[model samples]
Target: MHLLFIADPLHSFKIYKDTTFAMMREAYRRGHTLSVCEPQHITWQRGSRVSAQVLGITLTGDPTQWYEAQPLRRAELKDFDAVLMRKDPPFDSEYFYATHLLEQAERDGARVFNKPRALRDHPEKLAIMEFPEFIGPTLVTRDAQDIRRFHAEHQDIILKPLDGMGGMGIFRVGPDGLNLGSITETLNRHGAQSVMVQKFLPEIVDGDKRVLIIGGKPVPFCLARIPQGSEVRGNLAAGGKGVARPLSDRDWEIGNALGPVLQERGLLLAGVDVIGDCVTEINVTSPTCFQEIFDQTGCDVAKLFIDALELAISAGD
Candidate 1:
């Protein structure tokens, strides 16, 4: 099978921990041809199928110069056996527009994973709201008074922008309400933008566990991104240490409950974030931690993902 990865630059990947690289390597080990393109390389004309200027690449098994690539050439998205969307986020306007193009490619018969419309519909931060039973006390709003009210109720709260990734712009307000107003204004831009406010789960010290669901099934292990020092965010990008461990019962519950539902919505892969027993975020956009989990638990998450991908493709056929 030929797989086309719509992702960030291949050169930018940290092969040791990059999930997309792990997936590509696993797929290549199984004898699949690989091609790649950035979202900006995709284009569509009024009367033509959506296509990308892609580079055919062969992995070198060397991280420094990982892959040898051919010159970019135009190819219709539908021509590939599978098109994997692995672009990282800020999910800004460009990413939004890219999804529309991918959706159009779907209409042209392209097999796109984590389906385009599904990605657009599930904003990572906002996605957790759907499963309130599994999450902490949460509120989504742009109004300062609403945030203040939530903060007053929770005493200890977390505030973050709706579109943030990698723990950017996240703030913790304690009982003293220190800088709660400032954080709210900063996160919501003085009511111009919306933010997510939740009761701070003290269990964050244990780690922010990433429960990966592939093909509507939970991976046996999850990577726990534990906060270091005085940091509150447990994201790996925020300098947290990653430790892979077997899924806890609550992790399994959340994963099992959301997996089939999200899969039905065309999400081939999802990373459900749990801090203690509460679901914090539902990460569908380029979810990572494949390498960390595999390194510690020997659970082969990327292989599971690719297996699911193959099954999905076959079923579609």
Candidate 2:
């Protein structure tokens, strides 16, 4: 199968730590032709048309030093069996534009993972509000008075940007927290973009679990990320330590409820974050944690991901 990954630059990837690299390596081992490009490399040529500069990729035993093929363009992306929208996110205008382009590609018969429409319709953090039973005490609003009232009610809450990913722009406010006025002003100054405020789960000190689900089934392994001292964030990118762990009954219940709907919507892969039984986020845009789980558990999750991708592509064919 010819596979294209729209993601960050190849040179910037830390082969061992990056999930994209792991998947690329598996694709190479399976003898599938792999091409990669960044989101900016995508362009609309004409109506319902798109193009990109495709870089060939190869993987060696020492995962860090992978090989690459000369960059080229196959004007018709449909020539490739599948395309993976693997770019990391701030989920800004540029990301939305790329999704629009991918939507065009889908119309032309190329299978795009996590379907462009689903990604656009589902903002990771906000989507979970639909399932309040699986979530913590949360409120999404831009009005400072409303936010103040929520703080007063919860006493301690976490405030974070609505469009944030990888644990960025997150803050925890206590009963005696300062700068409520200033923080809300900074977050909503430009416009009325609402921020999320939820009751802080103190059990997060033990670590937050990242559970990977593919093809409507939960992967056996999970990574429990322990935050650094005095830090509320447990993202590996934010200096958290990832340790392998098994999912609890609550985790299984959450996955069982969310998985079928996600697969039905064409989201073949997802990474759900759980802290003390409350679902924090459902990551669909290039979810990570594969490498951390593999390193600690010696499980090659990349193989499972590839198998699911292949199954989806073949079904489409």
Pick the lDDT winner: 1
What is the clash tally of candidate 1? 0
lDDT (C-alpha, whole model) for all candidates = 0.93, 0.85
**Can you tell me which runs of candidate 1 are displaced by over 4 Å?**
none
How many backbone clashes are present in model 2? Answer: 1
The clash count of every prediction, one per candidate, is 0, 1
Clashing residue pairs in candidate 1, if any?
none
List runs of model 2 lying over 4 Å from the truth: 62-64
What TM-score does model 2 achieve against the real structure?
0.96
TM-score of each: 0.99, 0.96
lDDT of 1 by residue, 176-241 (tens): 999887888788887899999999999999999999999999998999999999999999999999
